[model samples]
Target: MTGTASARRSASPFSRAGVLGIVLVGFAAFIALLYFISAGDTGDRGNTGAAHASATGLNGYAGLVRLLENEQFDVTLSRTPSGLETTDLLILTPPLYSDPEDIAQILEARDYLGPTMVILPKWSASGPPNNLPAETADKFKDGWVALGSANTLQWTSELPAPFALTQKIETLEDDEVPQWSGLDQSGEVPTKTIAYAEQSALHDPLITDQSGHILALSVLGEEDSEYYNNAHWTVFVVEPDLVNNYGLSRQENAAAAIALVQQAGYEGDYSAVTFDLTLNGFGGAENLLTLAFRPPFLAATLCLILAMLSIAWRAFLRFGPAAIGGPEIAFGKKQLVSNGAGLIVRARRFGLLAAPYADLSARRLASRLGLIKHDAEAIDAALAVRLPEEEPYSLRADRLREARSSTEILRAAQALRELEGKLAK
Candidate 1:
């Protein structure tokens, strides 16, 4: 008996609390998995293009990223535009084929974002060919060219007019090295020349080449700028080659890049430097889920979550104990009759039961009238005498005995019921 009771208990479903706990655990596990998959650090901290900071290509800025990390600066590669909405220094290295209007939108949206540096694209490069041996392929050179011609400034023309490229590539003389403070010039500078441009009156010169064209310009913010105000500082670097992979190969160029980062006010702080990948053809795609959790639809997401929680709470509160059924063989005549009728109907034997039921009804009626020894015919004749002349009880009894289908049985049974009512009267 104890073993049977224990088995029944073990086979039962979980209680409300137990089910709730299981659901909560499953939800937590799902959230943890999502976080690990989406945001875990795999250490590729640069743009997605072939020659950006994350790439190992000759024109990439991976060396610059390493150099900054070596200097104890926290540098993160941001794959989404939301990562740009911070107080850190944001560096954007847009590709040559990128839309200028899109770049303009990103810049315009950075009203409250901290110091931003836009590095003008300088190299036209392609990836190495596929047919070479692994060692030779790994050492393949990226076919890069300096964008010094006027026609190559089409993309730059779409930028804010003050930061536009000027079709001039100024070559620095050996005696005309930059005099910027904090720049380490002990080692060789990779390229003596870089793309040059003129800045507006609002901009201040940070670095210049031999021909006096500005290579770097900065626009500082006001002293008491409000949050999200349009007064944040913006820096424009005319030549990216000065800090890219080939350039950073020279220790002097790497040092110069570090100095420029410090000049942008990220000298000592970790998590203060962020590189942008959205413009380099990475991660900016938005879907329904992403849109729902963003600004305009965030309230909708909250409402949906609340509705789900409310339903769950209601379900938990309304949960009741399991219901136990009665035995298959129930007591009482009404139940027995119902069960017998159900069995006859299920077996399609209603017509066969019609004659037997009529005889039993007649015998019961005769006994109720104190004529216990009378047979079915005598009971039917007595019923006919009591019933109306238009509907004879004997005729109903005969029809019930001769019924050959469920439909005929139903009609005869209904007539017999009417005859019984008349006989009772």
Candidate 2:
């Protein structure tokens, strides 16, 4: 008995409090871990693309930004038209200008600005069709050429020897009195020929106009100049292989394209490449950071902080014991049934149930007999008429009397129940 009492005392209010604390703290720690995993590192800092593009810094355009800096020019590579105004001689590359909408916008800007040199690199074909209006196409046709032989050079064979590129050329045409021998098809119109390939095993003569003006010359001997008015406003080079980055990366090809551009009389201030974020109303440096801190993240942070504070407050504030008689206690199933049985036995032993049971049986019997009146006199009369047999009626009457005695009450109740079943049938 003493050990049992000790065990009961050991499970006290303070011990229960400690267990609750462990559970609450463990849950809070789990929640905290989830929050950190989802949020990652929030305070990481680096140069924003806008800041880098605007500062003439090297962080904006990936690796190529370094190359532009090394060449002593500022490049702001932008997606917006207004950004294009910040520099002269825009050098467009793939991807950024690959979309038709962006390309059309850039081309539209050409008429307003000075002459621009478009370098058709090898992968330039991925861009959408210019679909430029016929008028615009004619105006810019001579200026723009796909980098291949049949398009720019008049004949396939007239192209220079010792050089082989990957394109098919059908025929070569002649200058007035120039040789067209052994060549069947006519050459590309002269209006489109800016420069043709001249170096070949066959005599790929360099052809020019009657004014000693060289139309297509060897890529190896391309020249540079300060004025474009010396020729027309536009110059077409049949194969820009001499100008694209793939070729320009090599010393020989790079120098050649630069010289040709210069010889075409393109002189302008080369500085900053701008990146346009105006389409998103996120032009300045703060826009990117603003997007990073939008509403959902803000709400989640607030909820986390509130939960932590609630936990800490509950930990420190005292939790008084639950009040006495706070809620009614519930008995076990067996205990409740036993209590009901005891009440019934006590009522029968004192004969307290005789009057109530007799009254109940009479009313029930009257109801079963379909009699409107259900007094004792009425029930007895109805039973006499319906049963007509005296024995069963007498037995019922005797059982009702016996219900007052403690020992015989159950027998009396059973007889009344049996009579009720018979009447129901």
> What TM-score, over all chains together, does every model reach?
0.55, 0.28
Identify the runs in model 2 with alpha carbons over 4 angstroms from their true place: 1-66, 79-88, 93-105, 113-115, 121-238, 256-268, 274-425
Clashes of each: 0, 20
**lDDT tens per residue, model 2, 1-425:** 66665665555557556767876899777766554433332232232212222222211223334454565555554444455454354443322123444444553454345334433222222111369677766664222233232232222232222122222222333444221111111122222223333333221223333333333332221234222113122223333334443333445443444444443334333343333333312232322333335786777766866998788668545343433342353588987867766887766454666556766876787789898876756666777777666335445656667665566776776677776777898
Which lDDT value does model 1 have at 293?
88
Query: Roughly what TM-score does model 1 have, to 2 decimal places?
Result: 0.55
In terms of lDDT, model 1 sits at 0.65
- Residue 162 CA error for candidate 2 (Å)? 35
C-alpha root-mean-square deviation, each candidate: 10.3, 20.7
Best by TM-score: 1
